[model samples]
Target: MTEQLSTTFNSLREAWLQHRPDERQRREDLLRLRSAFKASLPQMTEAISRDFGHRSAHESMLAEAMIVLKEIDHCLHKLKKWMKPQRRKAGWQFWPAKAEIRFVPLGVVGILSPWNYPVNLSLTPLISAIAAGNHVFLKPSEHTPHTNAYLTRLLHDCFPQNRVSIIQGGADIAAAFSSLPFDHLFFTGSTAVGKKVMAAAAKNLTPVTLELGGKSPALIAPDADLTKTVSRILTGKLFNAGQTCIAPDYVLLPENQLETFIAECQSQTAQRYNEANGQTDYTAIINESQYKRLTGLADDASIRGHKVIPLLSLNDTQKAENRHILPPMLVINPDDDSAIMQEEIFGPLLPVKTYRSYDEALRYIITRDRPLAFYIFSSSNEPVENALSNVVAGSVCINDTLYQFACANLPFGGVGMSGMGHYHGEEGFKTFSKVMPVLRKYNPAATDYLRPPYGRFADTLIRFLTK
Candidate 1:
């Protein structure tokens, strides 16, 4: 394994040293990868489902494969234009000198992908690195063993391992990966683990794009359309069983409308998944640990006078083992110190907090460190604009959540506690690239001033230009 990894980096360094691929060659490579991904979507989806026990294929397509395909297509179409060296205006003293920024690939990149959206998060950034003309080393999360195995096989089949390889294992392997002094590192997981990754990368001073998850909140003002509000919030919350980094972790609503909003949300759940226990379309939590964590939050909240409403009517008597089938839950007016609010809730629990006014809601959302994503469910354009402008987050959706990430033109990432850097779209290429600015003075006409030995006119010109 060590030999394989060393050879991969050596080959990528060799590639960068020997030749810089032209725009056509870069595009051809991206298109080939894109086509390969399109052909393998079904197999990838099946593997993901197998790994998770019951991940929905439609969810996989919508949340992972389709988004990845869009990103690939977007990059392929725009890379040539993005690759063009940007000319910059120079000062009067440097009239003959031209300055430009060139987006150059940073050799071999290391990507440590989480299991939630293994295919999309793992392969999408790989596409960006490829588009940026860098070889990649992808380490898909080992928790999803089946998916990781398939990813390794398919990537080795489609692309040369030395160019793009998938390394697999648990924490030790992940730690080993973070130790490698790659040109850049891209990681997606919890903020706690993200900090560890950052620390590990610090040893090599490797720049990283940490796509960490946070407790993203969605606010609904008094005048908002409850129907549209509940529908969108539920989709974001329940998508991947609320495993998404940008999923609505909880909600803030006007106190008077709390009951109305909950009723509508419950109704929406029924319409989508119905009341059946095991037949619910939305999948289970990733594993027993996650399920226990979520249930513990619910149990803890219920004990603290917070109302717990499991959207589906599932009896506690239903055959329960380590299967971890906790249904989507709604916590009403949970205490500020509740466990759900203590950290990023990456499960099927959505806590609903009631606020009196827009300022109160805004304060609640902003009081925490800037989140990965913020959401507002309001028809009033003023409030939406105010929220978007005032609050700092990786991304925002005015009347919805999570869908903003689906747009390949948009940059997806977090700020502060949520995360540091961004990826996706043209930003993805920029994230994996080192945009070094180059300046050249080719005109001999300008050499007279530079070659002077303290002549009065030359000194005067230099002083004037410096001033």
Candidate 2:
């Protein structure tokens, strides 16, 4: 597998060296990329659902298929503007010289995408790279074989093997792919794997954008509407069974409103899905392994005396283990040292922590490694504004969740250990682009007096400029 990936990488690099795509060719390629996905929407949806072991078709379409389509449309409309060089003002010291900032295409870009939201993660970066006029080599997660096959075929139909391609394989291939020293490496996964990817890329001084997972917290501010707030939190947490990186990992509740929020959460979660089983719009864990891992998290929390409550009454349904469907759960006041509190709970287990004051909540969040996302639900903008001022995050959704990614105008990334760099909106274009500053000296004698030669005039000019 590693050998095959190496050979494919060589081929892609050679292709990039041979065919440097201009703006027009890139536009044509992007149009083809969007068209191919449009033609295969149904197939793409089905492929992802199958790989997820009963993933909701609506969720697949909304999160993966629909998001990719929107991203492509965004790139297509803005590519021309994004490609144009912007005139920058030359300082008075360099007066009579013209300056501009040009966005140059990096060579071959290598992307390592994740299984969750497979289509969106795989193609969003690809669109940005292509729009920036670079070739791409993508490797989708091995867990999503069905989706990978679809991507391999769909992308091939739109592009030649070298211009844009997919390499389908397991971890060995992934490790090999990361070490190849591509011009840029874009990765979306857990922080552990992100560290490994960055380390490998460091060998070649390859720049990387890691969209890694962290325990994102949603704060329920004072005067928040309990019903509306709970509904929004459930929408973010239960979507994709909480496999999203930006999904609210836990909820920080105002102590006075804890009971009201709990009641509302129970009601909202019940109304969101027909059954906790695999029969409704609710999704299953990707496989038996993930199912076990999530259950273990809950069980460990329970044994440690934390209150782990199932949001639904699953008494009448088949065992969740049998269907690999882990129901949504709420953990009340977990121990600070608990695994559920310390780790990125990527499942539906949302631990609720109470705060007596907003200062306490803000301080708690600040004490940890910066998260990929933060949610503030407040009736008034003042509290939200205050929290926003005090907190730092990769992205923030005010009075809601997961809507931050919907805007193609904003940059999405993490700070500190959550991850580094960004890849969405205009930031995505810049991530794959090399911003080169070009200065042309049309007037030759602009700095003649400042040049070497110790003269009274030179000294006077230097003193004047220095002053």
Per-prediction TM-score: 0.94, 0.96
lDDT to native, each model: 0.83, 0.87
Off by over 4 Å in 1: 1-4, 275-280, 315-322, 445-455
Candidate 2 residue-wise lDDT, 154-255, digit = tens: 998999887887888888888889998799999999999999999999999999999897999999888898888899999999999999999999999888
- Expressed as tens digits, the lDDT of each residue in 349-405 for candidate 1 is 999998888898898888888888888877778888888877888888888888889
Residue 305, model 2, lDDT:
92
Q: State in Å the error of residue 274, model 1.
A: 1.8
TM-score of 2: 0.96
Cα RMSD to the true fold for all candidates: 2.3, 1.8
